[model samples]
Target: MSKVLYIKANAKPEGESKTFRIADKFMEAYKKHHPQDEIVTLDLYKEDIHFLTVEDVMVHMSNEVEEKENPMKRYALQFKSADKYIFAEPMWNLGIPAILKAYIDYVSIPNITFKYSENGPIGLCQGKKALNITTSGGDYTEGMAAEWDLCDKYLKTIMGLFGIFDYTTIRASNLDVIGMDVEAIVNKAIEEAEELAKTF
Candidate 1:
């Protein structure tokens, strides 16, 4: 069966986070379509995915010499096991959260997730897809605020390093602070997510 890795980057549990609610709706729709598919949810807030340090980089690079397996190795394995990936995060400081970035640092290793070649760095994890579900308090669709969207671009670039080019983004920007209809905006994001889940 196809496997999907859902990474929840929000620290808030349930009612406090609007991003979590949107992610839950997207996952529900995905489950309805692919009931038999395996779903692995990685809650970043709960997990202790430490930021990459110099020691960690050394361990990754000297794996052959050290010949010892570690937690980072396990993380890399888990990342390779997924056929599809889903990121649920809120836009923070025009970018993703620190936890998600930490996870990415752990997974993006040379000769594992990707490799350097003469042509360029080639992604080893091919034939995989990804979906990024994000919410922001600021309006960033197609206006003066569009250029400030760093979340989508960062996620896309990181996923592309693993050869995951087939991707979709579900964004609900200006949800809380827009002074507009919040329910309608959220429902619209849900509708978009449902449609995207069908294609996935």
Candidate 2:
């Protein structure tokens, strides 16, 4: 059975957060489809993901430095071991949350995730897939704000850096707009998520 790392980034709990609800619905279907697959849920808000310092960066970069007791290694190890990933995050200020970013920082090691080559930087982590889930109050997927829609795009790009280019997205866009059927929009996204999960 393959391992699926499910990362929940919304700070608010299930009943209180719309993003959490969408993630929950999608995960439920995913579990149903792949019961034998090992699913590890990493709640980023609750987890203590430490931010990297200059010293930390130096330690990772330096081959002579024997930094064996690194706190980030466990997080990095788990990420490296996983065959697939599902990131359920809320779009904040046209980007991702600080907590999720911190987690990414911890796991993104130079030789571990990627390496520099003559052509360019090449990703080391191989044969991995990802699915990014997000909810936004404003519609950034279309119109003039599309340029400002950094959440999903960032997810794809960063994951691609680690050799994960095979990815999909489930976005519940424009939730806070006036006179909009938020429930129907969420339900439609949930349906889409379920369909994707079957193949995912």
Which candidate tops TM-score? 2
Worst-scoring 10-residue span by lDDT in model 1? 62-71
User: lDDT tens string, model 1, 1-200?
Assistant: 89899999987888788888888888999899889999999998787789787888886785442232666766777888899999999999999998999888877777778878999999989999999999998877786677888888899988888888988888998876857788888889988888777768
Model 2 over residues 1-200: C-alpha lDDT tens digits?
A: 88999998877887888887888888999899999999999999878776788876775675532244675666776888899999999899889988898888877777677777898888877799998889999888777899998888888898989988898889998899999899999999899998998989
- Positional deviation of 83 in candidate 2, in angstroms? 0.8
**TM-score of model number 2:** 0.93
Report clashes for each candidate as comma-separated counts.
0, 0
Q: For every model shown, what is its TM-score relative to the native structure?
A: 0.93, 0.93
Q: How accurate is candidate 1 locally (lDDT)?
A: 0.85
Tally clashing residue pairs in candidate 1. Answer: 0
